[model samples]
Target: MPVFRRRKGNLPRLVPELDDATLGQVRRRLETSWSRGSLDTSVIALVARAIEDAGQDWDRKAHRLEVLAGAAGRAVPDMWRRNSPNDQGAVLLHAWSDLLQAQRGAEVDLAATRDACHLAADLLPADPIPWTLALATLRLERRPHREMSAVWREIKARDLWNREAHLQALAYLSPDECGSTALMLDLLDGIRSVMPPDAPTAGLEIITLVRNYHRAFGADGRAGIGAGEHWRRPDIARALDQAVQDWLRPGFLTHATAVADLNVLAYALVKAARADEALEVLRATNGVATPWPWNTEGDPLERFSHWYGRVGSA
Candidate 1:
């Protein structure tokens, strides 16, 4: 579970201690960190927090969101181009989808979400998040029943972590299924394994899983099981507050993971009806500080820019 410390008004100021050259180096490292298939998870955690802490400054938050998305996009193709599949690439793709999905419902594009899920599946066959995303995308698209069942079956056949499977099951199963509770618990176990060691944001995946479970089952049923579980508490509003803190704590943010973590956390919070917190996180990151507007105005070269703008706006 994430460490939840109340934010005292007395929280220490965030001093920018890095010199320009050092800052540039850090940025470069963050931008390219995914090439190795692993990323500094803490860095991403921090980015999420920074965005959350940014509060109310849409322009700044937007800029930060763009930067985070741009870096992730640049690193994504490298995952597929390599001879071996990279987990970070898949993670980044999912991260992008998480970000896009968090936007106002009207702004979401099923095609883009589908593309992101497909990319993630191609990059990390072992990880179930992408497949789950694909299923969710199908649901969003209102695909026919047969296709949905086929997708669900395919997901079930994979050696996915239990929580992922439970999540998939929750997405597709009827509530009366006798073993659903046990399945969710098993899913929680899987999430525990994936939590980053020594990072506040480690519990995020579990939080997301439980939240989704609740959405599928309602507060009195599956959602109420972990009434007080650190990450699965029924009090979604408080959980969101804690998630923001975990993502922003000084030790958690890193360049490579920032955008992805922020995207996921923001989406989760918004879905839980904590849009105010989500907006605050985005603003704190100075996301809109950059003047380039995702570094694209027009033309093919501006594809990255366009993505950046969309990410920020979302």
Candidate 2:
């Protein structure tokens, strides 16, 4: 017998509304739907939309759905017996939601995120969303190269051009003892090619590439001077400064691409000894709390603070 075998009776439906009371009501009903042991796809989709409408307060609804999704993933045989496509979709949606929450400074469990990603991978083999999420979780956990190598192989076997995959790969392949510059640049070029013209990601990739180029080849090489010295070059400084300004425009705010670009810009400015401008940019960017996941770190914050502090003393 399936865990979510719908009783041969009337099924409960969620009420439509964007208000708090209505959202609350819908959330409760969805919980009940999950408790019945059957994954309800329609209810899952509705709940996802409702949570999105709630914006920052989506946490409450997301928590409830995440429990249900986990249950469905664990009870796969039961879900299959119940013929519950909804249950499957609910699992993926809930995982994606949880991953987003974790990316946000929330206290979500890494194990849960990994499990969700694995379930999503099995359920949506053709979909890049699950693979992307899984790769991200692996990177966050800082798995060994052997483990990451397998994940990277899977990604490469599929669509190597996916934005999320490329971005995640960029982060995973750092310039530290673990990564190769030639390989990283190749990945960056792939990322650059697929970036949309107006997308802030294009600018962000350019900055990352430039930074890495200098790091690998040194200031005097073909990539030009290091950021610290490049500011002395009027043309180079002007171009970078303009790119930073373009990323700060109102239309680009709240985008992951913009956040990455701003982070790179902040670093570039600091290295160029423009502490005041760096501080101003960081302030405008909300100082590290951008909504988009994937690249949230304190390194930029610490570096900016140190740079500004030193500038004040000087």
Candidate 3:
């Protein structure tokens, strides 16, 4: 199950430090044009931003995502009626494809979602969003592994470095969910092999390790990791060292989800008793506390602050 859940009264909020001004502007713009016809490039970009933000709070992000997608959906029929479905319509359809999967909340209408994704892909042959959505839908629907591999090929053919696509692929191959640790590691190695040494997507290796670590240790009886677990794996150590270098490279910090990936890395380093290494990752975060790894501890912001404080005092 997801780490975040309704406790007593109020729903969980995202770690405040993760607020991004640029994405906030995109959201505000979409909100302002809620009733307008025809979508813009910024609308599609906002959808991407929303997908990135959902890494923290899926339900809250879905609510905001539907608001923007619903507006775009309302405009699409008229746009298609006037000039045939355009790029904007393609993006709106892609957004709906995601919104549909999100709305179902684990009980997705797989066929409907797939059809929507295909329509969007046909409308905009070169866009990666549709393929990414297809990948996500397939994973959610628990479709055949072969089918997901086919969709992943489509995504990689369009944009090899698409971070969202990679995340979905990882989810499909997660040990606890569908695939095994060996398969997950192979996927990471395959992507890292093709990507440039410093590509932002290379950070995915570190993120996957962190995710897998939590999946194993967070189990009901697991409580804590033992000495020989993933935290001490030689492969994880090497990946962490390489990922830290790649993460610190200039220009990589611009990705919408870079800070979240950094947060995962920092959490892993701390758990592995490598706080000295984690200090640099924490420093790179610039105080942005993503709601993950920390969410497992409750009040993600305070947990992140506690770690950052320990790193500082060290």
Candidate 4:
């Protein structure tokens, strides 16, 4: 069986290590779905996870989803095509959501998008992807806060611990977007309070902190919370410490997004100049790169490799 062999400079392609057989299964599943009309919840779920594993580069990620969605749509039988609520109907909704996300920067029709999402929600009443997509579209379009909140509530009502939904909400609440640092922090606090310490989202607080820190301080290492000791705010430090402790334990955050969470933690620790802590995270990551905090500084894997070298030498 083949595997995703790790290399130091595979920029934008770093992902969790998947053995050849498992990876082949995922590929075959996707291919089969595209060839025929196997637009079930399982197919959509697999595609959703693939999107997450593609890292945070919106254009690249969107393009992959666009292809899958388009191919799946074209396979639908013409006799069964009026968007009635069914498995194929849900997939069609996902296709619309994908196209909307791909065209995020350009002018979009909000009303039509919302209608599509609503129809998706009706089709997949139990699935959280539609709700997550709604939150993402609202974030991209910079829709009203109340509207975002309403959709957020709908998501939480369905699956409170949905990682994708929380991520979408986190991006919407970041200082660079609709929310300020305080608002983002508050959102983290609320999530932390409700989530168990071992839950996958236990690492989100640190991710949000890192995003806000970068937002306040430009890409340059200078400014904002200051470098080294000065960067250690009590609240942020406490949150990071707790996240680190929880993350290091056995069986913690054994989800598909585990590597992404670690990527955020490692990036945050490096920015804070906590070399030892960052090294711990890097060691755990084993060179799997997820964009997030490192995209602003050029190739994420390159930055990760540079920092790993510095920490190792130190």
TM-score of 2: 0.46
Ordering by lDDT: 3, 4, 2, 1
Using all chains and alpha carbons, the TM-scores for the candidates as numbered come to: 0.32, 0.46, 0.72, 0.72
Q: Model 4, residue 310: displacement in angstroms? A: 6.6
Give the TM-score (vs. native) of candidate 3.
0.72
* Number of clashing residue pairs, candidate 2: 3
Highest lDDT scorer: 3
Each prediction's whole-model lDDT (CA): 0.45, 0.52, 0.64, 0.63
Candidate 3 ranges beyond 4 A from true positions:
1-20, 28-108, 219-229, 310-314
Candidate 4's residue-wise lDDT over 1-314, tens digit each? 11113343422245423122333355567678666755565665665565555553332333344444544443332222344345434443454545444564555565665666677678657655566667777877789999998888887887767676787788788777898877877888788887877664666777666666666676656764464443588888887887778787767766655767788888887777777898777666655666667878888678877766643345
Residue 190 in model 3: lDDT = 82
Say what the RMSD of model 1 is.
15.0
Clashing pairs in 3: none
Off by over 4 Å in 4: 1-13, 16-85, 88-93, 96-108, 309-314
Superior by TM-score: candidate 2 or candidate 4: 4
Positional deviation of residue 176's Cα in model 3 after best superposition, in angstroms: 2.6
lDDT for model 4, please.
Answer: 0.63
Per-residue lDDT tens digits for candidate 1, residues 1-314, read 11111333212122121112333343455566666666755555544544444343322333344344545553433332242234433343344435444433545666666666667667646544455556666655556657666766666566332233344455443333323555545644554566553342354453455455455654334444443343345665565666677766665654323443454454455444455666555444433222211112233224222322333445
Clashes of each: 30, 3, 0, 0
RMSD of 3: 8.2
